[model samples]
Target: MGCCTGRCTLIFLCTLQLLTSLERQIFDFLGYQWAPILGNFLHIIIIILGLFGTIQYRSKYIVVYSIWTALWVAWNVFIICFYLEVGGLSKDTDYMTFNISMHRSWWREHGPGCVRREVPPPTTRGLEDHAYISVTGCMVEFQYLEVMHSSLQILLALVGFVYACYVISVFTEEEDSFDFIGGLDSYTYHHSPQKTSHVQLKPVYLSK
Candidate 1:
């Protein structure tokens, strides 16, 4: 297969996916976002499997990887919706953590150029005093950061899905073509098949 639409391109894409997924996993871990963490874990595993398949020219593994890419695209879309508050999904909620904790995105507190301030809360009748954190000077909002991450993931998954399908088709064609021929390379059958069955030939090419 050619490099542009072949296993080489798929391998490069999968490697890039692995790196980005690992980076996202680290931030998700810091934020204690259970859902994204789990998804990233699975994505990493499948990407490695896809990389192995690409290297070894295994069509079945590529097929599984291709299917996973489609599902991955959907997963990222859900994440984008969740972060953007589309379809009634709220970013302020702990939906990403599966309601296990109140911990929010790390970027909410430590985003680029963001400044966090703590101030006393309003007095409540017979209630304990509390302090609230105020974030300002953020170059970009946290929800947008999350959305961007998901968007990037979606883009990579779509590209990978396309390359994976092409690679699988190429693999299939190679298999079919090999079977159509007798699997012969540079050697010709000058003698009977039984006589040339052994690999202990004098030499593939004669000296004189």
Candidate 2:
């Protein structure tokens, strides 16, 4: 592999994936989106593994990473669909939180330039611990933001997958080209007969 090709490119892409996964993890944790949090955790770990495999030339690990990248792409696609409420998937559903809490995405209420206004309780009889605040004036909606994140992940995963496959092939070629026996003799560049230089040869003038 050249300085920026096969191995180097894969390593760099995996690093980028790791960073994005971490950023998504933090936001998912803040929003208490349990399912996404778990996914993000796994993504970060696998990305690290991918980086390790790329550096160490471990083909098995690279294979695992490539497989996971495919899965990650699918998972992100589902996220985009869920957020977009496509195929009758509702974002309001508590699936993200595992139905453990009513807490929603942090961006829902605190999106860019969003204002949260407290709603007056209709009755004193039934009031929850948390106040009801309506979010307004969001420059970008939370659903779109979520979709964007997923899109970016998908894009990175696709590129990473290609490079990973290339690296794996490269690793295989390296293994096949090198000979291993009980022990192999050292390589000598001059093992083949050296060519005699014309200047070092006896001149034909000697025939005169």
| Candidate 2 lDDT by residue in tens digits, 100-204 | 887778889888999999976666556454566888999999999999999999999999999998889888877866755212444333432344454457566
The candidate 1 region of ten consecutive residues with least summed lDDT is 183-192
What lDDT does the true structure give each of the candidates?
0.89, 0.86
RMSD of each: 7.0, 7.3
Segments in model 2 whose C-alpha atoms lie over 4 Å from true places: 1-4, 123-130, 180-208
- Ten residues in a row with the worst lDDT in model 2? 181-190
Each model's TM-score? 0.83, 0.83
* Candidate 2 TM-score versus the reference: 0.83
- Candidate 1 has which clashing residue pairs, if any? none
Question: Model 1 scores what on Cα lDDT?
Answer: 0.89
Collision pairs in model 2? none
